[model samples]
Target: MRAMAYESYGGSDVLKEMRLPLPKVAPGEVLVKVECAGVNPVDWKIMAGGLDALMDVVHPVVPGWDVAGTVVRLGIDVPEFAEGDEVMAYARKDYVHGGTFAEYVSVPVRALARKPASLGWEQAAGLPLAGLTAYQLLTRLDTGPTDTVLVHGAAGGVGSLGVQIARSLGARVIGTASPHNHERLRGMGCEPVEYGDGLTERVRALAPDGVSVVADFVGGVLDVTLAVLRDGGRHASIADHSVLGSGGQWMWVRPSAADLTELARLADTGALTVPVLRTFPLHELPEAFELSRSGGAAGKIVVRP
Candidate 1:
């Protein structure tokens, strides 16, 4: 199988296409024939060694976590799925070695969820990791109908999904983004607040009493989040750990079949949409990395094998 792998921690320059053997499925896992792989900011961050201290890395690493594919073979004792099942997952392992940026990937049954029939290969590929991050963050903060929620980095992969999820929960959402992306946010039922000077005032202009819940997807906004959060309100960050000391939770997404199943249900009902901004062939992963690093995309990037 031809796949992308990086032998060392570096930038896109290190990624290379190679002919590798199909991964053997372990018990409780399934081998998936990759249809599409989602490119995330974390993909490149991990490639750059940004997560060196937090997670162990193995050389010749395949860098991707979000995958949409078909099960080709089932490992021993894996009764949840069989060959030919269409599935998707946030397939991160305890260590970085094999991954979804390949022709085939071995995924754990615990992390598997049936792909939404309503979503295409690329869109389904985009959902797992980013969608789970947004879903977990909102639910952890206890978002509900009576609340007015604020989403930082509203137009990116996670924030875009965050706004839709909040809306589905009946909460009014205010999202921070550039003026150019405001129209997209509005389409998702989010009130767009430009993120720069006067950002707090802009959000306050809409919420007045300050938002009841704050979900931060982008880092470096701790001060801004605090300013517009109502006293005693809930807040959390996926990017910033400082929130832990400030009466807020610092979150990391966990892969759960149950959570991904709920998100799949939302997509099937037309309550959620994963807008795919671009697609690249599997061998062109380095180019995909460059696009994700540019920080200009307002939607998810995908790769088809």
Candidate 2:
């Protein structure tokens, strides 16, 4: 199989396309022929040797976590899926050979879920990591029809899905984005706020009592997020680790097949949208990585295998 792997952690340049042996499945796992892989901040972060202390190193590491593929074979005792099932997943974080940036990956059955029928491989590929993170954040808020939720970075991957999820739960959503995305945010049922000077005041003007809940995707904006929240309202941040000093929780998204099922439903129903800003073929993975780091890409960057 052809894969992009790095013998040592360095930068995107270390990611090279080569022919490597296909992964072997263990009990409770399945082998998937990957169609598309979704790239995230973690992909580049790990590539840059940023996670050296936290991760155990093995040479020739493949760095993607999000995969959309079809099952080609199942491991011993795995019964939930059979060969030829189309599935999508956020593969477990530490599987060295299960990285999605290849023609095939072997992942645990626990991490897999059927891909939504309405979406193609690229859109299905985009769902797992970002979608699950957005779902968990909104779920933590316990939002309801009576609540008004504020989401930061409304135009980005997780934030874009979150804006719609919050609205789908019957809550009014107020989202922060650049001026250019305000109309886009509005289309997703968000009251758009520009994330700059007077951001707190702007949100306050909209929800005078204060926002019922605040979920920040862009870190370093804690002061502004807390200021706009109603007294004792819930606040969550997924970005930086800076303490907000408000008894709020710092969130890290975990992999969950159950959560992906719900997100898939939303996409199938036309209540959610996954935008692919661009797609790169397997050989051009480095170019995709460069664009991903440069910022201001319109939507999720996908890699086709």
Candidate 3:
């Protein structure tokens, strides 16, 4: 099988296209023929050895966590799916060897779920990791009819979905982004605030009473969000929250099949949308990684094998 791997941790230049033996299905796992793979910030973060304390890696690491594909073979213990079943999942916990940046990837049966029939492979590929992060963060908050929640990075992969999820839960949504994404954020039912100097003041002018819940996708604004939250309110972040002075929970999202299924249903019903900034072939993974790290993408970058 053809795969993209990086032998050392560094920048995108370390990634290379190479041939490797096809992975065999393990007990309780299924081998998938990947159709599309999603690129995320964690992929590059692990490439830079940012999370070395939390996980270990080996040579020729595959970086993809989000995948959309078809099941080609099932392990002996897996009875829920058979060959030819189309699915999307978060695969591989080990950044070194667990990955979907190849023609085929082996994943536990529980991590895989049926893809939404209405979505294409590219859209389905973009949902697993980012969508789950947004869902889990919102679930940790005290969202109610009178509560207002602020979402930073409102136009990016996770924040875009966070805005919609908060609104669907009956909370007043406040989202932050640059001028270019203001209209889109408004369409998602959020009051858009520009993310810069006086961000708290801008949010105050709109909400006046302050937000009850804040979900920060951009770690740089933790202080600003803390200032904008009302006393006793909660703040959650997918980024580092050690510097955040709030008492609310600092969150890290792990893959969950139940969460993915709910997100899939939301996308199928037009309540969610996974925007794709670009698509690339498997061999061009380095380029895809570079684009994801460039900080200007309007949506997730997807790769197809």
Candidate 4:
């Protein structure tokens, strides 16, 4: 199998295509023939050794966690799926290696969910990590029909999903993005506010009495969140750990088949959608990493294998 891997932690320059043996399936796992892999900030961050303090990384690491693919073989005791089943997974293992950036990846059955039939391969591939992050944050905040939710970085991958999920829960959403993306946010059922100077005032103008929930996908907006959140409101951030000291939860997404199934249901019903900003062939992972690092794209970056 041909895969992109980096033997040492570095930048996109370290990623190179190489031929590797197919991974062996372990009990409670399934080997998937990769159709598409989602490129996330974390992928490149890990590549640059940003997560060295938290997670262990193995050498010759394949750096992707989100995948949409078909099962080619099932490991022992995996009774929920058979060969040729279409699935998507947040394929993060207990360690970093054998990831989804390859032609084939072995995913634990616990992390696998049936891919939403309504989404294309690229969209399905984009769903797991970003969608799961958004879903999990909103769930943790206990968002509801009457809540007014504020989403930071609302045009980016996870933030876009956060806006839609908030709306699907019947909450009125206020999303912050650049002027160019405001229309896109409005189309997704959010009241769009431009981020930067006077962000608190802008969000306040929209919510007036203050929002009932805040989901910060972009870091360093703690002050803006505190200014616009109602007294005793719930909040969480995937990017900011400081939230933990301020009565808000700091979240790290956990893989859950049940949650992925709900996201699939939402997609199939037209309540949720994944936007692909660009697609690159598996071999062009270096370019993909460069794009992801530049952070100009408004949607998910996908690599088709």
Q: Among these predicted structures, which one has the highest lDDT?
A: 4
Q: What TM-score would every model get versus the actual structure?
A: 0.98, 0.97, 0.96, 0.99
Give candidate 2 misplaced runs (Cα > 4 Å): 95-97
Better of 2 and 3 by lDDT: 2
Instruction: Kindly provide the TM-score of model 3 when superposed on the true structure, using C-alpha atoms.
Output: 0.96
lDDT of all the models against the reference?
0.94, 0.87, 0.86, 0.94
Error of 3 at 149 (Å): 0.7
TM-score of 1: 0.98
Candidate 3 lDDT over 1-305, as tens digits, reads: 89998888899988888888888788988999999999998899898998889887877787788999999998998888989999999775644675989999998877788898878999999999988888899987766677899998888899998988888778999899999999988888889988888998999998788888988888878778878899888888888666445576678887777888888888888888888989998988988988888886888899999
Top of the candidates by TM-score: 4
To one decimal, what is the Cα RMSD in angstroms of model 4 from the true structure?
0.7
Residue-wise C-alpha lDDT for candidate 4, range 82-143, written one tens digit per residue: 99999999999998988999999999988999999999999999999999999999998899
Quote the positional error of residue 118 for candidate 2 in Å.
1.2
Ranking by TM-score: 4, 1, 2, 3
Model 1, span 73-180: residue lDDT tens:
999999889899999999998999899999999999999999999999999999999999999999988899999999999988899999999999999999999889
Error of 2 at 261 (Å): 0.9
Q: In model 2, where is the ten-residue run with the lowest total lDDT?
A: 92-101
**Clash count in backbone of candidate 2:** 0
- Candidate 3 wrong stretches, greater than 4 Å: 243-245
Higher-TM-score candidate of 3 and 4: 4
